[model samples]
Target: MFSIVVISNATMVPDEAAIIQQLFEDGLEVFHLRKPEADEQAVRLLIEAIPAVYHNRIAMHGFFHLMEEYKIHRWHFREEHRQETTKEEMMRLKNKGYTLSTSVHDLPTVQRLTSLFSYVFFSPVFDSISKHHYKGVAADDFYLEAEQKPVPVYALGGVDARNIRSAMAMNFDGAALLGTIWKEPANAVENFKLCKQNVQTY
Candidate 1:
């Protein structure tokens, strides 16, 4: 299946709990909770707001320890975070049956490392939608690397309905949207629908 993973806004979404629940109910595959600024308590509160049944579909980018108590089965570590985490520790986490995803900006890392992950986010497939001056890889460059894709690589930067087809055309396994999902509507749920539609139609 062409997967769709929705990432939380860097800060917080208005009525985020409601929006996330609606998206899950509406058939979102993965909801990546990525509040870089929030502490463990705040993260707990956010997770607590969602229905218990949907918790397993949620993945987090922070507070790894919370995964055990919260029973969160999926989590992602940025490349830098992964660097800080010892390989043995990461393996231990994997052995415990947690699905680990990570970020990779270089082609070689993907070739060498994707075997270790459930999936990986290959970013800036188009351009940066949120960060200032964050240059994205050219479409040709992306395609060149993507042609050798060994695992599920979710296009992460500047992904939206209009360009999701580009990701699919490049043979990406899925698209992980952030700016489009958070900035498009009164609630981000509409964009989630659009994203899922694009995944089907693109």
Candidate 2:
């Protein structure tokens, strides 16, 4: 099954929370709460808006405490965040029942995460307007790296309704969207449906 991950940004906060909830209700499989600057209160507020049934389906980036509080099972951590926590620490986290995921910019990093994570995110397969200086990795490069991965690799960055089919054709487990959904709250539900339809067609 293909998954749709909704990536959050700081600029769009509680205002966008209800739209996010709508996406989840509309069949968005995963939601990645990535507001690096958002405080604990902001996170709590957003979670509260989302129904309890979907809590476990949501993934938060680097908020272990919140995960425990919300009973969230999926968690994502960037390489830099992984560096702060040791492998043994990660193992302990896994023992406590967190489905760990991490980001990779290259093949070597992908290789390193094989044993540690259940999924890896290979980003920037296309230029992303939401992020500055994020010159994406070529599609061919991503395919080569994904071929060697032991776990599922999600294609992130610059994914939208237009090019999602291409990403799916490459055998990505799924694609993540940030700007495409958050930039236009009113269209989020329909946009997500269109993206999912394209994925199904491919």
Candidate 3:
């Protein structure tokens, strides 16, 4: 299956929960909750606003304790956080049925983390839409085939409807959308739909 992962905006948006629920209803496979600035209570409220049925589809970037509370099994660790985690601890979490994921900037790191994470985000497949002055590698520069990687690799950063096909051509297992979806909150679902359509053709 072509995996379509939508990441939340760094800050809250109007009717965010409602928009999220709509995405889930529209067949969004996974949603990464990445509110780095929100406190536990704030995050809790947002999670509370979302239906419990969709909680399992959420990948919590922080406030992991809520996972147990909400019966969520997906967890995301940022690059630094993943580095600080001991192998034993990661294995412990895996043993308990956690679906782990993380981010990486290069292919070497992705190769090194093969077994530790269920999947990973390789960023800047194109220039970022949200962050300025961040450049992405040319698609031709990527040579690894999907079968070459130990774990599934998702292209992240600057992925949108126009270039999703390019990511798939580069042999990425999937793509993660951030700026493309949140750049205009009103178009989030439509943007996702377009990207999904592009990926489907691949």
Cα-based TM-score, every candidate? 0.92, 0.90, 0.96
lDDT of 1 at 40: 78
Q: Clashing pairs in model 1?
A: none
Question: Model 3: per-residue lDDT, tens digit, 1-202?
Answer: 6699999999989999999999999999999999998888889999999999999999999999889998899989999999899999999999999999999888778778858688899888899999999888755657566555789989898899998888888888889999998999999999999998887777
Alpha-carbon error at 39 in model 3, in Å? 1.2
Per-residue lDDT of candidate 1, residues 47-105 (tens digit): 99998899899998988788878789997989999878887888888898988999988
Model 1 misses residue 155 by how many Å? 0.4
What is the Å distance of residue 155 in model 3 from its true position?
A: 0.3
lDDT of 1 at 173: 86
Task: List model 2 lDDT by residue over 165-202, tens digit each.
Answer: 77777778878888778667777778788888888887
Please state every model's RMSD to the true fold in angstroms. Answer: 1.8, 2.0, 1.2
On TM-score, the leading prediction is 3
Q: What TM-score should be assigned to candidate 2?
A: 0.90
Candidate 1 stretches greater than 4 Å from native: 144-147, 185-187
Worst 10 residues of 3 by lDDT: 138-147
Count of backbone clashes, every candidate in sequence: 0, 0, 0
Question: What's the true lDDT of residue 75 in model 1?
Answer: 75
